[model samples]
Target: MKIENAVIITNKTRLESLIERFNTKAQAKFYIEHSGGNFSDYEQEHFVFKTSLSAVVEKLSVHFKCKVIDRSYLPNYIFTEKDLPVVLGQDGLVANTAKYVNGLPIFAINPDDSRYDGILLPHNINNFEDQITRIVHDRFVYDDITMAKATLNDGQTLLAFNDFFIGPASHISARYNIKIGNENENQSSSGIIVSTGAGSTGWLSSVCNQVSRMSETETEIDMDWDEDQLFFVVREPFESKHSKANIVSGYIDDAHPLIVESFMPQKGVIFSDGIEKDYLNFNSGAIVKIGLADSKAHIIV
Candidate 1:
């Protein structure tokens, strides 16, 4: 599509390398999200370097022959909904930032793939020049992946790109009162996971013991959940004092009345899109609903 104007958003270390590689044509900016006392690795201590991100922005502006704007200038650029520019960030920041910016397509760059999962990332920064050129020149295609929606008991609704999980916050077992349309399932188990087609490969696979493929059709609203049907996996039922770990698998019609009971008292949390959204209380007739959302995520291949 011939990107005459673009913005470069990245973490500190990768910014230097990205600027040295990509030749900017028109307008480009570098944004650095402040990381304070946060360690990249769990074993290492958190430390901030002496060089600020602004230095990298200035250097990149000169090197790439583009205008380098700071994070403060983002609001000015984001004047209208259509003014949403292509953003580049690490895999971790892509989905969340895209959601915040009202569903902008984030081109995730995998700086180091060995340490973490880079499944969503397009390519490593080593091929930054070629990949960016291809993206700008309309040489690649992007897909809009469907997202899942959940409504809590308190009438709070949220959207998730990956999966929505309802489970115990602590290590103890928990219960969930679940209802899918008219079919009711009272699950007394560790938790429940309502996953999207995109999240079929992750935790849902481990729980259901089956790999899930991405949905080909846009907004496939099939409620039929068999071995082949998509939108499944309600697992790790709560074990009562007299009961065992009851793990059930079935379609929407086969999902029976679910009620989870745990001896250990703990708060159960609901996660939207792999992020902790809210907490649910074990009360009389507390209902948790799971379904597909109308929104979707645009993905570039």
Candidate 2:
């Protein structure tokens, strides 16, 4: 079998959280126990992740050239075409990493299945060897996942495996000019959420849930995981003399993209997949166009 290089992406465990709060494991244990925080649960969770990681590393090393990396470094880290990413986390982490990975085949591995309902994670510690063997031999199936992209007038672009949040950085109201298809409106609200198929069941679903609750009639929309189109929902559009709320929610595709012009003078921001730290400025004079990206996530199945 031709060996392909593999990148194992793992995140920090709860032990890091314990260390962060108390500065040491002993102090963390003391703090947790004294506060009735169940230190044993933390210990068990940490042990399980460490064991799974050891197994993954040991197995992959025998098959291909592999390296382990932390989740925090995924943004700055570069991925090659021949590199297969083995993401060891929950469904959200898959989505987070997918945005930067381009079209590389991602082997999603759930470190602890009992703790997570990983919709995107198909492999675990026990069954990962078989999956890795197949991947090395070029025998596997993958799901094509379409993602959303947002381009600013300044030439900066943001990609979302799940969705994009465009709004104010602070608690104040956000002002923007929204264009959906041919209709355009000046909207004043909280923000706008543009979603892809991967995000339809996530942030997009919450918006739909709220809509269902507010309306008297029942509403249902079929959202398939590999769907080509995208969805956008404007949050809390206020009706006034200058701002309109008619074109608040709609669909976007190759033919029609969601466009927005920022009216905010300061603190306006645009970020993808709920990662707030990585974002672009969307203050006044910024025009952002959100649509489907040419890149897709190839998840090993």
Local lDDT at 266 for model 2: 99
Q: Once model 1 is optimally superposed onto the true structure by TM-score, how far is the C-alpha of residue 105 displaced, in angstroms?
A: 1.9
Model 2: lDDT to the true structure: 0.87
Which residue segments of model 2 deviate by more than 4 Å?
1-3
**For candidate 2, lDDT tens digit of each residue in 1-301?**
3546778898778887779888999999999899988998999999998898888888888877889998889989898877888898788889888877877889999999999887899888778889976887789999999898899998999889888999999988899999977799898999999888878888878888888899955655556667888988889899999998998788899899999999999999999888898799999999999998987888999
> Which residue pairs collide in model 2, if any?
none
Least accurate 10 contiguous residues by lDDT in model 1 = 43-52
The lDDT leader among the candidates is 2
TM-scores, one per candidate: 0.57, 0.96
Candidate 1 Cα misplacement greater than 4 A, ranges: 1-90, 113-117, 131-140, 210-230, 238-247, 250-266, 277-286
